[model samples]
Target: MLLLGMAWTLPNTLLGLLLGVAGLARGARTRWQPGELALVFHRYPWGPGGAMTLGNVILNTGASLEVPCRTYACRAGLGTEPPVLLADHEYAHVLQYLVLGPLFLPLYLLCGGIGVRNRFERAADRYAATGRGWWPWPAPRLP
Candidate 1:
């Protein structure tokens, strides 16, 4: 299943590798995050100083995942905002990428690109908080 997912998201993963290579040229370092099954590049000197997930690759603006995950609490507008682990949030995205394959990017943009209004992001946060319900599309209930 892992190999299948890697193949399914190969295109996006390739794009991610290109970006990672560029980051490496500028002093960024990388590590394989086994838990997430993703390659993470940190200390990347670009972007808005956060993390961005591209398929199985995760790019971080800080030295470690915790650095960016702890930057701000992941609040789902539930009155009380609790800290959401960025790693788990990003792993949710990887799961999304696996399920959606190449369609994830286009569909993500169609939803709202990025922000509180994006259902994808919300679902990811929910997954990070509760460890389930990552599927954004409605699933038929099993009888």
Candidate 2:
């Protein structure tokens, strides 16, 4: 299943690798996170100081798994503190990529790109703060 997911998101993952490699030339560092099944590139010099997830890759301006903003930090227990769950948020995106494959990009844009209004981002934040609700759409009830 992991392999299938990887293959499903290969296109975006390749693009992520291309960008990540470029960041490496400018002092970025990468680490393979088996748990998340993603390659994280930290200290990426090009962003406006935040993280972006493409398929199974995460590009971070500060440090990997650190929240890019203070929006719900207090609620998440990461208010001006260490151990942020930014990784978990981005992991939600990875799950989306796996399920949607290449369609994730287009659908994400259609859903509002990135911001509070974006269901994807909102869901990701929800998952980070709480251990559930990662799926952007409501879960189906069991019979």
Candidate 3:
């Protein structure tokens, strides 16, 4: 991970900065917490639809996303399902970024057209499902 981070220096730094910025913005928009990584809870505001939120987890896009970026997930006024599942799953993506470094996004996009990129989602989901995270056991069932 260290080598990859270094190998992708400029790109990863820019992406990480973007992610960090989003994390700041999201935190300002809602409640932000620090954990295994960063967390934006309550509500997510800032997207193509003027803060449009489709699901629990909102992903950051672009070449700047070569690294793990800020993920917007809701905590309240969203639904009854626990947000921890989303958080855990997202952190798994961070781990993926750590492993793949700059290759994460390109590979993710090439695979995105298929099942919201099932390959990546499955790994994250599986990680969340394991209950090996900071939250509870049994992640929320997703489609």
The TM-score values for the models, in the order shown, are 0.89, 0.85, 0.47
Pairwise lDDT winner, candidates 2 and 3: 2
- Model 3 — which ten-residue stretch has the worst lDDT? 49-58
Off by over 4 Å in 2: 66-69, 72-84, 141-143
Candidate 1 per-residue C-alpha lDDT over 80-122 given as tens digits, one digit per residue, 9 for 90 to 100? 5566778888888889998888999999999988776787887
> Each candidate's lDDT (Cα)?
0.82, 0.80, 0.42
- The segments of candidate 1 whose C-alpha lies over 4 angstroms from its true place after superposition are 67-78
Clashing pairs in 1: none
Candidate 3 Cα lDDT to native: 0.42
What's the C-alpha lDDT at position 96 in model 1? 93
Output the TM-score of candidate 3: 0.47
**lDDT of candidate model 1 versus the reference:** 0.82
Locate the minimum summed-lDDT window of 10 residues in model 2.
75-84
Q: In terms of TM-score, which candidate is strongest?
A: 1
Write down the RMSD of all candidates, one decimal each: 2.3, 3.8, 10.7
